[model samples]
Target chain A: MKVLSRLLQIREASILLFIFLFVGCIGIVNPAFTSGDSLGLILKSSMILLVLAVGQSFVLLTANIDVSVGSTMGLSAAVCGILLSHGVSGYLAVGAALVIGLCIGAANGLGVSFFRIPSIIMTLGTLGIVRGYMLFYTEGRWIEDIPHYFKELSAAAFLGIQLPVWIGGIAAVLAFIFLSRFSVGRYFYAVGDNEAGARLIGLPVRFITVLAFTFSGLSASIAACLFVMNIGFVPNQTGSGIELQVIAAAVLGGVSLSGGQGSLFGAALGAIFLEVINHSLVFLKVPAYWNNAISGFLLLLIVTGDSRFQLWLKGNGKKKKQEQEDMNRSKLPKSGEDGYEDKVVL
Target chain B: MKIKWFYRWEFFLLLLFIVEIAIFGWISPGFLHVNNLLFSMNDFMFISIAAIPMTLVIISGGIDVSIGSIMGLCSIILGVSWSHGVNVWLAVIIAIFCGLAAGLFNGLIILYSRVQPLVVTLGSMFLFSGLALVISGGSKASGYEGISGFPDAFVQLGNGSFLGVPNPVWFLFVMTAAFCTLLHFMKYGRSVYLVGINSKAALYSGLRIKWISLSTYILSGLGGGLSGILLTSYFSSARADLGSEAVLPVITAVVLGGTSIIGGRGSIAGTVLASIVIGFMQYGLQAIGLTSEQASIVIGAMLILSVMARQSSFQKVMQWFRQRKSNSSDLMY
Candidate 1:
């Protein structure tokens, strides 16, 4: 019963458990799916998504979203690629990417904070605008000729793990500490939980909101650097259709669409889970096109289950409240002592 | 009269429309030619036609991002039906029904499941796109090759002009007028506005908020279907990717026209004028040295700048400057 209660408490964790069990079942059916190289490749591929999800978790915690992260990554990578091709040092190229990403993020923050536009609409608009800028800047051409050192940073391994996996691990650790141990992190939850309450308490809501987006931007720049290093070429379709994947990862990780909940650890694990499932499908000889259908099916199942679980929780909360009310009623005296008892109860 | 003047975003749109024509006419010598002007209007007709119901949907406190995919799906269905030797008119009706069905799915999930409209529409956007790709087998359908013998009357709907103006433009004008009249003059229209402003309040007042939202989505679906049919006829080809790029442009037209994204306050007249403004801007910029891709930068900048100009921060800054100047003058005195 305790285990059941605990399972109910962490519904997303249970979902993750079910996913792993399913993956394990698949592995038992196809032993080849458990190979080291396959696992390594999946983790490496998930690194960018992991980074993106972490960044998005911050924004979502503040009741905002960064739908343009994918495009911003593409644009940043394109910037990096352009500079590196022109003989800029790798560090300098990365710095430039971060600065450009910061500018874009600042623009999104300003739009939402000052313009009073909803984050969803603002980000959606920038998704196109940023992608358009990237296209115009690169003239729809692929950026080839990335330096070998940068490529190694993306693909190379340490202690039998790829660099990106290690980077993702470090990022997750840092994010966990920052969110759990810091006052600023508590402020984010406060703001997302009840904006009017936070404002009444005198929290710097706008600055924190902007800071969340800046973190999102910085993370996207990092992901872009990792992405360009891995692919060695930046195409116009580099991050095409990635917004869905980022949102899916965050949602599957237990991030509430309405905001104020979720963890970076859950987001990373969700990214890993998604990437592994994708790899497993390929390993199991599923057709590439069927992947979308499968993911869509899984997404539907997960979201419906989550929503049902939420409904159950709400019902339980209501029942508990009603029970408490009944208990209070039963303890009350009949008519004559009502006034004295009411005063005592109050 | 004073109340009307104060509430005249639509009138402002008209003034901008006149200014656009004058500016474009002066910039490009050929802009004044009747044929060029007619052709430009024709080029913009499809987007404007599609923006009609979208305007209503936005004002009804919901959004439909899947219109582009619905348009593509409808076009594909129309082409497939035509290729199967069905009558063109019946095929068009079937295509419109397909669009309606897709939109119904969106409305049901959003209303019944209590999902956020943004998330639901985002999911449906991909769902419809995937469905289109799967049904079409990821290939373009050149039904013009097989249906080359379209009836002259059907062809004239796309190609022929009336009274020296293109038929497409006339269709757009009629549809816009009809929608404007419906949105402004009808009780249902007022209900839509009230619902958008406050759903709970509307419900308290005995309005069917869900039905209002659902019907607007259906209307958007129909609008998308009409745009698809027109586009398939105009380009004489149908593909799964036909209207994919129209999503951003249509939303931009709606938002740039000064319609509140949060819903309740907007004007179809504003949307019409905004479409014209965007159309002229695109054409005029293209007429200059800017490539189509570069023109996106300008459009993007304008969107950001317009929103920024509406910020309270700007107003605060202006007030601060005024206060500072006044204080300094008093000290000097």
Candidate 2:
């Protein structure tokens, strides 16, 4: 009973268990679903999404979102590709990408924090503006013929895993540690939990808000780099409309849309879960077009369930408190007049 | 009456409008011609028309980003229905109803499920776009070829002039007047304002907040449907991509008109005038040898600058300057 109750407390654990069950079901349908090569490919494809989800988790934890992450990723990739093609070293190109990402993220943060623009509106504007710049730079052309060294990084495996998987692993571990062990991480939770209170306590409210977006930008740039390496080319549509999937992943991983409680590990698991589900559909020979509809429906279900569960938990907590109060009152042995007065008070 | 005039943002917008027209007339003699102005106005009529109810939705503390897709969906429905020997009027009604259904679905999901409007609408944007693609098989519906046989009266609704003004422009005027009055004068309008300002307080005051929000989305759908119809007739072609470019312009017009994105404050008249401003800006820039893309950069910059200026701190600085000037004049006296 204690274990069952504990399981209910950790909502993300149940979601992870559900993902494993889904994998098992898919494996029964097609053994290829569980093969080493397929698993590796899934991990590689999910790496960029995983990174973006980590960033999204942070912003969403603070009751905000960064819809511009996908656009930032595209912009960064295009800048990196253009610079690399101009004979810039891969390292320099990567650095340039990070800078571009940081600038864009800072702009968004400033709009939201200083100018008092809502994060969604600010990010929505940047999403278009950045994408427009990318279109202008690329002239609607895909970037192919990347240097062999960059492509090799994506292709090479360390200890039977792709480079992207390793990168994802490191990101997940680092995010988990920062969120769990550091004062800054706790500050993020505190801000998300209650901004007014956090401010009253003299937290660097505006700076922390900006830092969340800066982290988001850095993660998006890193994700873009990984994407360029893995995909071997950058298309105009690269990362277009990917914000939805990343947000969906974070939400599905038990990140409350209302803000405050979530885990980076849960976000990573969410990305993996989505990838596995997509793979399962392909393995089951479902039409590719149906995937969008199915995934959208699943997201709606999960989000609705999370909200209902939160309400239920709150209701149960209230009810338990009431029961405890009732027991405490009943414990008093009373004379008739005293009992009558107690009943009137109740 | 005095209070009303002071509170209206439209007066300021109208001043801007007159100033722009005068400047453009001076810069380019052709801009003074009625035909040239009307032609330029016609280009953005779709966005102007859609912005009316979009203003209401945003003012009510929600957004309907799916209107672009809703317009596309309606156009396709109109095209398909017309090709099937359906009566044109009936086809239009059906098209409008289709848009309403889409909006209703968005409203239901957002209100009943308590999902964030941004996320729900974002998902529906893709859903509606995908549905349009599937229904049209990723091809243009070819309104020019398919709708050639539409009656003269129907076509005249888009092209024919009334009192020397284009019919669509006149239609825009009528709708703008109706919406502006409805939003500013009616009891329902007051409720919508209250709901947008503080939904919890509105609920406590006995307003059916959900229904109010739901109705705003429905109004947005109706507006999108009207735009879809006009676009179908004007372009003489209905395609799945018809109005895809209108989303940014619509949002830009609203924000530029000083509508708060966090909701509760907006004006229909301001939006209408802002749309005209944008229309003129697009035309003026194009006249000066800027491509559509470059024009977009100018519009984006203007939006950012306008938002920054609207921030309260900026207002305080201006007030301070005015106060300093007044104090110095007193010293001189």
Candidate 3:
């Protein structure tokens, strides 16, 4: 029971357990779903979302959002696909896509940090512009018959894991390290957790904030490359609506939209959970249409449950001190000797 | 200097609107006719409808992305129920109820959990649209094949006109008046502004913050419901994707109308006028042989430019006016 409570306390643990139970239930309904090979298929399919979520975690950690990511991926993949189809070398194609991502991400960062535009509107405008640019550049044409080498690279397996899976793993691992290791890494949480305090402490809050956006762009571009490689084609609607998926994954992994909480591993786990749910919909022979509703429902349940659990643990059941907490949250700390700073010492 | 006229939002927007009409008429001689203009005006009002309530929501320091999903869900409910032998009016009412429930759920969650409104609404955006799909019998019955065979009275509600004005345009006018009055003239209006400007202060001032917040969302839901029903009538069918394209335009209208995204300051009048401007601009661009997708690019540019204009300080403009005045005086000397 102690272990059970411990498992429940960590969002990642609970999400993992939930994923397995869901899969297991579907297996009961259809025995073939629990097979080892199908489980590998699930992991393989989740790789793109996992990579995107890892990137999104960096921005969410800084209390900002990048809604332009979906279009960024689309644009980058289009550019790369066009370039590769033109017989450009693979390295050059990759370099060009990364450059495009950097410029766009830098623009997003500057718009939010310098112009003081809200991140959502800034990125939303960018989302439209980037997608428009892609359409115009590609002339709304699909780039098919991508080079055979590129397709093979994406599909090639190592130690039973596909290339995209390995890339996603490296990304997750790298995100965890970058967020946990460097001193600047810790600044993201500080700035996001308490911006004014971080400023008062003489941190390069602007630099860190800009860096998060850049990292988000870089991650999305990487995902774009994987996308182009995996599917070996670039359609007009490529990467459409991916921002919501990446965001949902990050949120499911316990990353607070308010920022300063959650881990990349939890986000990766969330990607897996979402992907598995998608897979289970097939296994259960649920109408092909109910897939979206189920995931959306699960997204609500998890977030709502997590919040209620936090409130319950705080011993302030519904109604009691609710207004008091509101007042406290809105108010600034009275002086320098604040205890809230110590709470994030990890 | 006549620069003072520019400082009045209504005067500025009205002047701009007139100038815009003249310019469009100049560009396309066919644009000046009333029948042509009013015909297109029918499709434009629902955008105004959604933006009207959204103005109140933004003025209260929150947003409702889920309104789009609410519209979709309501449309689906009306369609599915009507196809199953229900009276169209009754089905519309049921659709409105679903909107209210969805909106109420959003308010309750945000109120109890104290989460950010954007994330909450974003989550529900997906949830409601997905539910709409399920109710429409999933992909098997979906993919642009909307439910049809509506009663003639309901069809007239979408198509018929009053005194040469489109019914949708009339609905827009009435809703705008009602909401503008509620937002600008009533005591509740003051509470909404007070809550948005400083929520903590509002709470301490004996205002019911919970109820006020909840009311904004409920009212926004009703706005979405009204638009959904109109959309069903307009097309004489209903689908799960109703109002999906309206999210960005609604947000754009609210912000471009001089509403601060951070909340506290907004005007219903500005939002209505801005929606008109945007709706016309979309039509105008398409009239010039630009595809709707290309026109979307232009609108996207307008959205960013409007927000950037609002974010910049008016001090610069004021300084320019002062400098011009001083230079004129020096020339007089």
Candidate 4:
């Protein structure tokens, strides 16, 4: 019962419950949505976002944001796609893309941590610079004609599930283990919870911040690779506006924007939930144009509801603790009298 | 004479402006013409207008990314109402009210929900833009088929000159003066800075933190609304995506003008000067045949570089370089 209560108290449990309720409601509205095929499609479509959200959760865990992730994804995919079209080796192109992503991420981290620029502003600047440069480099054109073998990688199935889903799932599981079980990984939480206290405790706060961003960039690159494979081409506008979705996904998964709270699993689930919403809208025959507005409304509603629920829980806990204290005080006098009566009888 | 004007960031910005003008003039002689300078103000007028309130928002330690979308929404509102036979002027007023309401929504959500301003504004950004698209009928045709054919007077409001200066230049000056007085000379302005510097302390000391923060967002919304209306008139068309591209440059202007994103330190003068510098830079770059995308790369780099240059760490690194130079000279001697 205690374990069950503790599990129920976790933010991930609530997110899971919300997802189940949402899926059930959608299923009731359109029975087709509940089918194994449609559900699998939803998970497949969410793989890229799931990968990006896990990376984002790292920076969020450290109380910093990386708005450049979307652009990073775009630039890397552009490079990777262009390379493949030019008949370059697949592994080489992928490595180059990863390196580019890492460098951009490191630059963001350096600007925010070393130069002391605000992470949001720093990343915003990079977002523009990177996007603009990519456009300029490509001359505002798309990179098409990617190699066939590379494109086939996304569709290849493993154990009856698609490759992208397996990759996203593995990334989330690995990140969950690293974050929860590793001592060094705990530094991100500590730094985010209280920077001054973390520094006072002799933690490398700046380095940890940089590491988190680097990991975020690395993940964006991985997502970019998947994007190239899945889409088979890179548009100049690749990953544009996707930062909003990734951030929304992380936040929906109960990752506090203020930082120091959330998990990789929750973020991944949030990604899947967002994808499901997108697909469900189609299944429900909603206009495609309404997607943006509906998603925005849902984000606001969920966040407001979650915050209100947290406040109520806090208030209830305080009241319960007060009652417990009052009960203890009343029982203390009776216990004292019983001890005295026992002594007299003796 | 007692003031060390050289030490101020605004002074540095002025110097940068002079340097930019000299360089641009050398590259394109026509760029130095007064008429050209005033005419080019039309290109970035919306950005400057929005940056004015954005200055206040940043000074209060909050950000409103939704302002750009608010501009779009207000523009659509003005267009739809005017087409529906309402007086164009009344439509503008109604549009401004919509902007205010959107801002109020943002302020209330951030205040009551205790969510970070960034997240709340991000959500609203999409919401406002989506509404704009919806109200405009979500047609790809709307790209070029936006509402047009406004009355001559309304069109003249955006393009006409007064006293040999463009109307936009005048608007910029007036708005700058009004906000300058509000930010630098008013008691309410002091409370904004106080709240931004330390909200907890400000609250304990009897400051109305909520009102101060909320008012900044309202003003920002008003600025967005005004930007949308002017943009509509300038182009003689109203589209759902009118100021969608303004967010980057507007923020660059405010941050470049020395408004710390962390809040509690900024100036209106700096923002105006910085916007002018940036506006001219873009104009000059385009005059020299650079694409808009290339210009964006320059602006983005400039934003990051300027901020990095302002950091104490950068200064320390410079000092260390100087020391190394001096120490190496001594060893050689």
Candidate 5:
């Protein structure tokens, strides 16, 4: 009974329902969309998105965002792919991608944690700097000719499931334990829920903040390696603007953008749902232009849903009170009432 | 830093702009021609126009990442409408209205839901851009080609000069003065600052916080619409992807111009100078032997550099955190 009730929880349940509804609607319109092959296709394509969203959940849990993830993914894929094509061993190529991820993640973490620039602005700036660096180094060309073995590895499956799927599944389970059962995991929620109080209680708030960002970067790099291994080529615009999609996926999965809430499972599921939507567009033969708008519309819808999820979790007695409280206390950063410089954290 | 010098970031930016120009002229003598400067100024009127209202939004402690996507949507509306034989001015009017509606939509959702501005606008950015692509007629022009064949008079809005100055520069000047008055001199502006500085205090002061917050977003949308109109006329075409690249520079101008990203403090004068500084720096870099790509990279480097200099603002952030902690236990929501 407990397991059944947990499975039926509103946030994840609603997302699950939407995925079915969307797929069913498309499946009815086009009989081919319901085929077993198409189902397999959606699952396989969602693997990369699932990977990236899992990565993003760590940072979001800490009450920060990483707009630079897309750039990090791009840089990782480019460097790894380029190295592979240049006759470097595949192991070294993967290692280089992880190193690139670590460096960018550390830089982003330092800027946000120590320098005190808002994560959004700092990451935005770094996005440009990293992209510009990539552009200058690559000189506006695509990185191609990745070894055939790399793509084959991604394609190979253990016991009928693809390799990437296994990777995502294993990562998801491990992340759930790490976030829910670990002290460091709880530290994220504590800091984001109340930053000053968290500091007063003697938490290494700075270290956790930076570590959260580094994890985000590290995830993007792993996703990058997956992407390069799967695609066999890294285009200049690879992962461009994908940060938005990744964030949307996490938010849809029930990860709160204001931070200190949600789960990696929800994030990974959200990524799956998004990829399913992206594939649905293709299956429905919808114009490519509508893709962005539809996903964006769904983002809004899901945000509304997430807030309702929050409300539902708050209990029935406080629903009205909480609703009223939300209206009164929404504008949080301005609490100083005097200092003109005070800003919103989340 | 004192409030007086904290208030002087824009002035410092202006000094930096002048220095950039002089350095460019020294590096390349041909860079100082009057015509080149005016024409260069024309390209950035859209940014300046957009940044004016963006200043107000940031001052109100909100950010509108969707504004660039709004510009794209409005331009497509103008392009598709004009192509289908709607009167040119009517198309523009319709586009601006649509843009205004989009902005209001952004405002409405954020106000009623109590969601953060960042999450709301980030979602809207994708939605608006997708809508632009949908309206652009996938079968006809596709996404990249956009829609052209606007009226000659409409085209002239972008290309024509007024009193020996380009239309965009004129647009920039007029819009700057208008925004300055609306944001700094008016009662509504004070309400905006009050709401941003402390909504609880604003409530006690008998201010309408929701309306002020909503209106700032609407103003931001209007600014985006105006820029869309200018960009369409200037490019003589409209693309779904138009203005996508300019989002960063617009935000850079607002923040680098001295507006606190946290809200409650900024000036139209600061945004204007920052706009000019960005335009000047881009052109100046190009003149002194930099590719457009290289200049863009430099601009990116400069964004990080400028933001890093504002380390003073974070101290107040800690105080704000304490206030939140004290209030959190008592506040049920």
Candidate 6:
């Protein structure tokens, strides 16, 4: 009971509660929504986003952003897809994709950390460049010749769920543990929470930032692998606009974009929540066009409400402290009161 | 580091513009035609229009990524209203007001919530774009086809010209002048700079920092709305995806115009000139037979190179390299 209460006390617990309520409402409207098959499908569909959101959460933890994640995903997927089509071994193709992702991420990290360029601008520059390069390399054409074995990887189930889902779930769990229980993982929070303090305390702040982005890029590559396998093809616009969605998912999951807050589980849950919203829109028969608007509106609503709630909690704490101070004053001796009166008068 | 006369960015941009025209004209003589040069402004006037207000947003220490989607939303709003038999002019006004409300929403949420402007605007960007799609999908004109056949007066707003210049060019000039006056010749402009430089100091000095920051967002939304209308007029169609690809170039123009992304250091004149430079660069790229995707690579590179060149650290590094080279030469002597 104590453990349960402690879990409920977390900021993400509210989000978890909201998700349950939301799913319950949807289930009430459409019984199919609660079905194991549908729920599984939602989880499967959100796996890519879950991974991306986790990666994005790391960057957010470091108070930096990588808008190029989507483009990197597309480019890496393109490379993997093209290499696979050319009969390259799966390991080589996947390795190339991950390396490409790491290089792009390293470039973004170097520009922001070493060159002193703003993260947004540097990543935006990479977004354009990577996207353009992918388009050019693909000759503005889609790759639809993915091998059957590659596509089968997404189909292969472990414990009644797809391989990718299990991979994503395990990745999220590992990341959560890594970010929470590990000393190196804690450095991300320290760096973002107080860069100057971290530096003064002998932390390699720049290297940590670069590591955060590299992790983001690596995760994006993993997402790309899953994306290509599931779709069995790669389009030039494979990950266009997914950056916003991934960031939204991370921010929605209680990851503060301003840095030094949030967790991987929250981001995974946020990704699931977003997928549920998308899935439920179809189930509820709302026009598909309303999906983006609804998701965005809900994101705004939740963020605003969450911040207000924090502010209220803070105010409540201050008031409690003030009342305690008053009570202590009332219990003070008369001579101490005379000293306080003299100080006030002075 | 002292900047040489040749290193004055705005002046250099002007020179670059002239050189661009000369080179493009030499490659394709028809590119130099007065009508071609003037009318080409129509293609990117929306970027110029949007960048003008963006200059202020960046100057006020905030960013609005939603203007692109807001542009699309406002355009769809005007189109949907007009398609429903409302007067075109009235629909335009309604659309502009909607932009104002969106901006107000952004400003209010950012101020009270104390969330980073980047994250707030990022969310709003998605919201506005999604709203645009919803509005369009609900309207009679659905799917890939856009609403068209606007009244002549409304169409004239985008295409009509006076003194042999396109209406968009005129609109761009007028808006630039108005924003320039508001930013350079007014106290409100000073407050914006002060707030950006140090919000706490500005607050202590009796400035309504919130209002000034909020007003910049409102102005940005106004620009987005106006650009949407102009785009619809120019193309004679209104689509939900109008200006969807605009955020990058608009920001690039502002940043290239010498506006510090970190805020408090920028100029209206710089933004205007930078917009023209970028607009012409795109046109000239296509004129030289490069694809738009290819052109974007150049634009992206330009954005990074320009900003990096402007960094104080970059200058220090360059000075260090030069000093090292001189020291080596002295050893040789």
Task: List the global CA lDDT of all models.
Answer: 0.76, 0.78, 0.82, 0.85, 0.83, 0.85
Q: RMSD, each candidate, Å?
A: 7.5, 7.2, 5.0, 8.8, 6.9, 6.8
The residue pairs that clash in candidate 2, if any, are none
Q: Write one digit per residue (lDDT tens) for candidate 1, span A232-271.
A: 8898777766776787787778776666778787777777
Q: What tens digits encode model 5's per-residue C-alpha lDDT throughout B1-333?
A: 244444356666877787888888888888889998898898788998999999999998888999999999999888888877789999999989988999999998886555678778988998999898888865367767868877789899989998989988988889999989988999998888887787778867878777888899999999999899999999999877789877888998898787878788889998999889888888787667666656767776777777776565534554566677669857966
Can you give the TM-score per candidate against the true fold? 0.86, 0.85, 0.90, 0.91, 0.90, 0.91
The collision pairs in model 6 are none
Winner by DockQ: 3
The list of candidate 5 runs beyond 4 A from truth reads: A1-10, A306-316, A319-344, B1-7, B138-140, B288-291, B312-333
Of the two candidates 2 and 3, the one with more favorable DockQ, higher being better, is 3
Q: For candidate 3, lDDT tens digit of each residue in B1-333?
A: 566767756555676678878888999999989898887878777888989988888888888888888888899889988887888889989988988888888888777655567757777888888888888874335655799878899998989988998899999889989998899999999899987787767767778877998999998888888899999999998999989878877888887787777678889989988888888888887888876656667677676766665566554666677889899999999
Candidate with the larger DockQ of 5 and 6: 5
Instruction: At residue B236, give the lDDT of candidate 4.
Output: 88
Docking class for candidate 4: acceptable
lDDT of 2 by residue, B220-325 (tens): 8888888988988887656666786677689888877877776788888888888998788878878876656556656665667656656666567656766887
Q: Name the runs in model 6 displaced over 4 angstroms.
A: A1-9, A322-346, B1-7, B312-333
Name the candidate, 4 or 6, with the larger DockQ value.
Answer: 6
Model 6: per-residue Cα lDDT over B1-333, one tens digit each:
344444456776787689878988998898998999999999999999999998998888888889999899999999999999999999999999998988888988887777667768887897999989988887787754699999999999998999888899999889988998999999999989987777766766778777898899999999999999999999989998999989988988898888887788899888889899888888998888777776777777777777787775546765786788789999999
Over A94-191, each residue of candidate 6 has an lDDT whose tens digit, in order, gives 99999999998888888877877888788888888888888888998999998899999988997787999998998888888899999999999998
Please provide, for model 4 over A1-346, each residue's C-alpha lDDT reduced to its tens digit, 9 standing for 90 to 100.
Answer: 6566467568789889989999999999999999999999888889999999999999998888888898899999999998999999999999999999899988888888888887877888898889888988788899999999999998899899899888888888898899999988899899888889999999999999898899899899999999998999999889988998899899888887767888888898888888887888999998776776777787788777777677666556677876878877764322211101111000
Off by over 4 Å in 4: A1-8, A320-346, B138-145, B313-333
Off by over 4 Å in 2: A1-11, A21-34, A139-141, A273-281, A284-286, A316-346, B1-32, B138-161, B244-246, B289-291, B317-333
